[model samples]
Target: MAFKPQSDSDGALSEINVTPLVDVMLVLVIILLVTAPLLTQSVHVTLPKTASTSANIDAQPLQLGIDALGVITLNKQPVINLLALEATLKAEFTKNKDVGVHLYADQAVVYKKVAEVMATVQQAGIAKMAFVTVEE
Candidate 1:
């Protein structure tokens, strides 16, 4: 590169020297294009197919929880009363007949509260119910 002062008759440079910037940008674009396909290369996978579709994929399970204070929740949303819980359950069942409810009751919660909630779930015509438990 040679040092050369560029100026007009007024001794002021009027135009910017953007040739180097354009060259650098073009080089970067070429590098990206060459490496893009290599970055996207992934192993070909053949996933095993099962006879029955997973419930988690088909429909999300509704979560029902009863705290030690006997407060009820459906899908983590608070329910004011058994009637409200029942209504929500009915709506869920109507939306997807195969939808299941996973009930989690705090150990300190009274059995009566849990029973009442179960009865209300039954009344809502939900046949598929599972008790969620922790491992050890």
Candidate 2:
């Protein structure tokens, strides 16, 4: 016998199956319906009211400057020597426990002078100190 071609009725299906798609959509709708109510549920709370008050701004930082010549100044006033600086710092620390120092050192000042000043500040029992520098 001679070879023969297949008939059109034996061709692959071209229509889409919608049963699984409808089932998945129904499941997702049911999940959303269930979760939507849960999402809206929240605990009712009663909070207490407090009196309004102004913020306290009492303390100011001390500005300490050291020039290239190794001369030290506190708050624009020159200090005699390291001993005097330590004494003054101790007094300031005693005056305000939260007092902080903003140190401004000259760009040409030596490292030794800066280190010595830092040591003196630490010896005076000051825990808060910051170096002030200009942005390049």
Candidate 3:
């Protein structure tokens, strides 16, 4: 490298000195190339394989709805009371151990009624339950 002094009469230097920039970019590129292969390297192992079976994908969840008036319905059909609901749920549970219920309660329904319904469901030996809500 050579040094030059600027005279008062000389115009300002507008050209950029990109030699250092080019040097830095080349160094970065070389580092990336060296690390790229290392990043892709992984340990290989022999994996064991077992017999595959299909799940019961056809099983559908039961839809239990409670209207604003606190009337309970199972699968769109009206139920006389919580006892009937529990009987129905017990039967369904017997049919499918993995049975689930999607509970849809009206917003205006009383919390006590909902709690009663949940208790009935729990007593029926059903473990999986989901609350159905409308998206805003």
Candidate 4:
């Protein structure tokens, strides 16, 4: 008579061999979970531009405003005249690349005044231009 184990007499797999597969799947799941956020992460910021739908896309914008008194304001700082304004703008564009300037003229301001400001901005090598207007 040969000696035999009692559990093997049933001729069935009493223990499962799934630990390796489970470990590999768990490792893959952990790797995906760790890297999911990084895959879609990005930086969001607004450089500046016009509200007009007709205006072209711009990356950076400089604000130029003329009040009812015909005073020129660059980014809200008052300037004496177009020459000083041009010098200041040129210096600004030198530091920032691909510059766009937006002109906000008061409704009471003359068309010639707005044109003059645009002229200076153009001379300073600022390529893009836009006009600011109220909706009403």
Candidate 5:
């Protein structure tokens, strides 16, 4: 038995026909070529250059948050007052001298309350502290 085309003629067509496949593939390639440029067009921007500062900090940072009610929290756990906040920071700093603190204050909270928290953190000897702000 020989492989043969099922057609009106009984004889086999020996040549492998790839013309239709090649035509379909070429059409796909052309479609991709037409749309690729549109997909990759982007806004050109002039970005400012700055000297990169080396960050030597390797310890996990503690988060201190003051919500709108003037309530304070140390790493999400509620602290009674600034004295408690200072105690928490002091204990954490004792474990890792380079421990950093990130402060998050709600927009409705008073600046004096935030400042009091900062002073407490400073008194705790935590030198690495930064105010966390949300971008518009």
Candidate 6:
């Protein structure tokens, strides 16, 4: 009887077959391409910085205050209504592009009231806004 070469068995292969892995990776890339744009269509972009000048920049923002009675005021005078606030903001911001809005709300003011004012400010198209809060 002679030894059969076909029957001789030895596990000697040390290489990984990665064709299936490559195929799965390619599928993932295609999926990303299809969905990425759809996911970000509604996004708004913030501007990037450019080197120019910081000398004229103010250290603080123009403060818009809401007292305990839910009254709106700018700097100290009562704005009386959203229209008044918008008018004042528009006038102040007409010459300055870097003007910022800071909002202070009395703790008694509800989230709805604050959000309404924020919406009005946003509609007025102010570039930046900050919520003023007290430290404990």
TM-score of each prediction: 0.58, 0.64, 0.78, 0.55, 0.57, 0.57
Clashing residue pairs in all predictions, respectively, total: 0, 0, 0, 0, 0, 0
TM-score of 5: 0.57
For model 6, what is the error of residue 22's alpha carbon versus the real structure, in angstroms, after optimal superposition? 47
The deviation in Å at residue 65 for candidate 3 is 0.6
Give all candidate RMSDs, comma-separated: 12.1, 6.3, 2.8, 15.2, 13.1, 11.0
Model 1 agreement with the true structure over 40-130: per-residue lDDT tens digits: 9999999999798554586988999999999999878899999999988899889988888899999999999999999999999998999
Q: Between the candidate structures 1 and 5, which one is better when assessed by TM-score?
A: 1
The CA lDDT at 80 in model 4 is 89
Candidate 5 per-residue lDDT, tens place, 1-136, comes to 8865578877765898899999999999999999999999999999999999987656679999999999999889999988878888899889889899999999999999989999999999999999899889
The alpha-carbon deviation from the true structure for residue 107 of candidate 2, after best TM-score superposition, in angstroms, is 0.9
Candidate 4: list runs displaced more than 4 Å.
1-60
Work out candidate 5's RMSD over C-alphas.
13.1
Candidate 2 vs 4: which has more TM-score:
2
Q: Flag regions of model 5 displaced more than 4 Å.
A: 1-58
How far residue 60's Cα lies from its native spot in candidate 6, in Å, is 4.4
Q: What tens digits encode model 2's per-residue C-alpha lDDT throughout 90-124?
A: 99999888889999999999999999999999999
User: What Cα-based lDDT does every candidate model obtain?
Assistant: 0.91, 0.94, 0.95, 0.87, 0.91, 0.85
Poorly placed runs, candidate 3 (over 4 Å): 1-11
* Residues 1-136 of candidate 6: C-alpha lDDT, one tens digit per residue: 8974664667676899999999999999999999999998876899899988768756456899998889999887888788888888887777676788899999998888888899888777787999889889
lDDT winner among the candidates? Answer: 3
How many clashes (backbone atoms < 3 Å, residues ≥3 apart in a chain or on different chains) does model 6 have?
A: 0
Residue ranges of candidate 1 with Cα displaced over 4 Å: 1-58
lDDT of 4 by residue, 1-136 (tens): 8966577367766888999999999999999999998999988988798686764464458889998989999988999888999999899889875778888889899999988988999899888788878787
- Show model 6 residue runs off by greater than 4 Å: 1-54, 58-60
Best by TM-score: 3
lDDT of 6 at 119: 86
